[model samples]
Target: MSYRGPNVVATSNADEKTPAASRDNRTRSATTDFLDPLTETEGLDLVGILSSVDETAYVWDLTTGRLDWESNAAEILGFDDTRKVATGAAFHALIAPEHLNSRLEVFSRSVGADRVRGVPYRLQYRLRPCGQRSETEIRVEDQGRWWPGADGHAVRARGVIRIMHEEYLEQQRQLVRNDFDELTGQLNRVRLTDALGAVLTRAEREYQPCAFLMISVNNLAVINETFGIEIGDQIIAEVGRRIRSKQRGGDVIGRYSSNKFGLVMLGCGPGALRVAAERFIKAVRETTIKTSFAQMTATISLGGVIIPDQAKSVHEAVNFALRALDIAKSKRFDCFVAHEQLPPAEGARLRNKSIAEGVIAALDDHRMRLVLQPMVSTKTGKPEIYEALLRMERPDGSLVSAGEFVPIAEQLGLSRLIDRRTLELTVDLLKRHHELTLSVNVSGLTCSDAEWLTTLRRLTAGNPDVLRRMIVEITETVALEELDQSVNFVDTLNELGCRVAIDDFGAGYTSFKNLKRLNVDMVKIDGAFVKNLADDTSDQIFVKTMIDLANSFGMETVAEWVGDERSARFLKDAGITYMQGYYYGMPFDSSDYVKAA
Candidate 1:
């Protein structure tokens, strides 16, 4: 280190100092000089302190392009000689190729004003030793202050270089964790989805073929139930490993969900997709997963869609692949289904998309209205309760029935929203109309949705009268599907002073045992059995048996679809508690009913 300019000093008169005063003055002068500029000995001490922490200080003279580094620069930067890093140009050459321009841009950015103090900068990059291309490249953090020259450009900089290899490695690990699944070590769903979109774009641009496969572990739910979830996770991890081993070099695999994986195969046509699917299937089926608890054989079902062919976008590709997966699962435990763009299916898909958009818009716009259909008492033929059916009013002043869009809503995972909205409307109606009793149907998805129950409790909280007038109806099929959850749901409703009815009863083979366990308040016989009850003896017997069963359980029975006087009379004679049908009255808008009342 060298000083190249005149040094300014403050001098005291020699006549003013006594012998003792001279000693004190000398001590003060030494301290004052240390602050002006570091002497050679002090500079060496600073270098020693910085070097102990793996840091090196430097001073660059921009006009001369000379870099003066501390004495330990060679040792700190892993260089054999100090000359290699003694100049700005020589030092810049050692910066990794990718980081060279970025490091230079830091100084260039500090060109204008703000030189009153100095422009400060901090950046991290890799540096490779000169003439050595090995994995030992150093990661460094360079932070410094630059001063402007007369031309308003950076002329000199003072900074420190810190070795950041450990921090850099930790950051790399975090990136891996973000992009990959913890259990399977495969790409996570988010990264996989991004990768799918990218591959689809590339395939379209390059006019190449590719395929996306959604592979699901068959009977995973049963496995999780039979074994523990931990063992199930182990199975999933092992399956991911097997899939990775069988994938081609260009293919990508990711953990799509708990029991499913998504694979993207580049340059794969429909025929190649089938072959690849089979290869993956065979790999998992042939090898039994050995876990610490137990060894079990697992098989996977796959659904595939060709890129830029069957599907063009990421959304379409994922949806189509899931559809194919459903078909494969329905066929058997281990099967592969390839998505085909049939005309009818395409039309249905478009229609579903339109309905989904409409549903969302209607909900947002508060266009979801309820229609009330009367369920009349069997003995006196007077309206007992009104069933609230969901309807979406269109912009054209027409209405779309729940049947037209509810299934799609369920498929698109919008049932919970609709259900919550319905609960709110029903509670409001019950509060407004003191003489009204209403039954509202819920989808299967809502049966297990804790949020829906929370919403229900919130809406009817402190208003037990409203809950008492409200009847929550769940389909018989849904109730039997997850009997335990349905039982709990029914119990909660009953506990809240609300009645639970198994709607569309007798549609599914509901065992008397399960029906008894459900402990519902009412069973609405399937309209199919009630519509022809007057003429069809079989229908009459089934209806009679269902009525008998309900009566035995001390549950009320509501006969639905009683289209004519004869059906109603027969249902009433068969001891039905309530009857609902067009013959009694068509469903009318609840607001209109309110106005009439």
Candidate 2:
């Protein structure tokens, strides 16, 4: 068998035009099919039985000129997942190159005259997980025994089926979910917590010091924004698999952040963390993650902590381990840093105080003013309605951007108030300017607030125009992850004659999935790539592609950071429909825009 050979191609065996009754009997019963997963009795369904069998099992026949594949078999066999597998040349293209020859060899033996009946052939099987791995193959054997049943039709011979108890199945599923990041398919927070915690406790019980390693990628937000979430998830998954392969036994590792991973050491001390950290850094630097683009590398800041008593509650120790990771991140350490080396804080007081006070001052003086930035019609060069910007004034009467205050408000439990203030201000602003459409920013936590919704309803009750001309820029980064609330918020807003735009469109956990399902109107390109638009060809291609993408979906694209003429011109010529920038205007007083006009 060869990579280019047509002889190995599999053909579809599925009946394209079979009778309904025949299909029904061959397929799982409707109830069993509709209810994902079957009860013990329902497991008798043929489809259910197929699903319950080995994940990679395929009813393959190289002798059959036609290639046909089962959908489950395709997923297990590393092919493009389809309704049913196909046989023939096209099917061979999807098989892992390493497995094809061996599979063909097995086919030769399974059908030959010398092959003993009921004999099972053990094969080392590798099913590449679409893109995550090279085929983490498990060795399994194929047993062949055929019998003429009462109907005189041939069927595969097997033993009595042992149905798993419902409770056991549910528990297994929960365990899998706990251990995996759904987006990246790497281990998630819960899994990491359990795995690392166990390692730490065991180490402590053994009275041996253990190390914890944490790795975080920088500019993940920008990467996510540039590529869209589907690609970002792929990159993250690849990085995780690489790291996992490098770690030795007794070390537990899992996704710790949207762009970070945590590792726990069993017996290795501080030195082990150091060694593993070095290996990780090297792997990350040398390795290029495969996305739609062929190659890309990520920069990671790593940190570690060594606990002398590994068994004495490593969970809390993980916190200390995280603190070190933060230190490494904040310091921009290219390599790894240890926990003991952390510097004492000069209080980060100025930062926290500025955030806390900024909100308080904005609320007290009503400095939280809503300024509208038009999402202008690219075709008409006229206003399409404006997106809302919330500006705050300090005690000095200087205007502060939301960037400087939003994070602080969130940390201090004041985002809901800020959101309410912004919404109220937006409504009032709309009342004053009936011709303008205003967009307001709402965070995840705010969207989940019932009181805020009531506040919004009340504010817009008396003025229909205020409600009609309003658009809310819900940041995809926040809104999509908390899907139910996000959808409800958008539905309510839409009912109130408001539209919703996904803010920071590509910079989130599940951008593509959200775009496909999220109830949103427009996409705001994040400012980072736009900040350096003209000079970076890669960034330009990225931005241009996203603009095209939004247009294809009947959504408008807004170029953020249209900071200067150069970027504005670049974005404008690149077919971007709308641009927002300091070049056109810094978010200013409504009076300033009016005066300028």
**Best prediction by lDDT:** 1
Model 2 lDDT tens row, 1-597: 322223445344454555656554433332233333545555455444556754322332233323333334443444444333333444444446877677555443433233224334444444333432444433333333323223332222221112234565687689888678776666788777777767666666787777777788767888879888777777777778888888897577788888888877777776777877889888877867777865787767887777654224554566566767777878754678787632435336544765797688779878777665666555777666666788887665767788778887788888888888888777776777666666678867878898987888888784666776777887877886778878887888777777778887667735565675776777889888798887888889888888887887888778877777778777878788788766665555765555634
Q: Which ten-residue region of model 2 has the weakest summed lDDT?
A: 154-163
lDDT of 1 by residue, 23-140 (tens): 3453334223322266444544565676788887777766566566665666887876545455576677678888877777776664465878789888888887543455568889
Each candidate: what lDDT?
0.84, 0.65
Q: Largest TM-score belongs to which candidate? A: 1
Error of 1 at 307 (Å): 32
Listed in order, each prediction's TM-score against the native is 0.44, 0.41
Q: So what's the TM-score on candidate 1? A: 0.44
Deviation in angstroms for 505 in model 2? 1.5
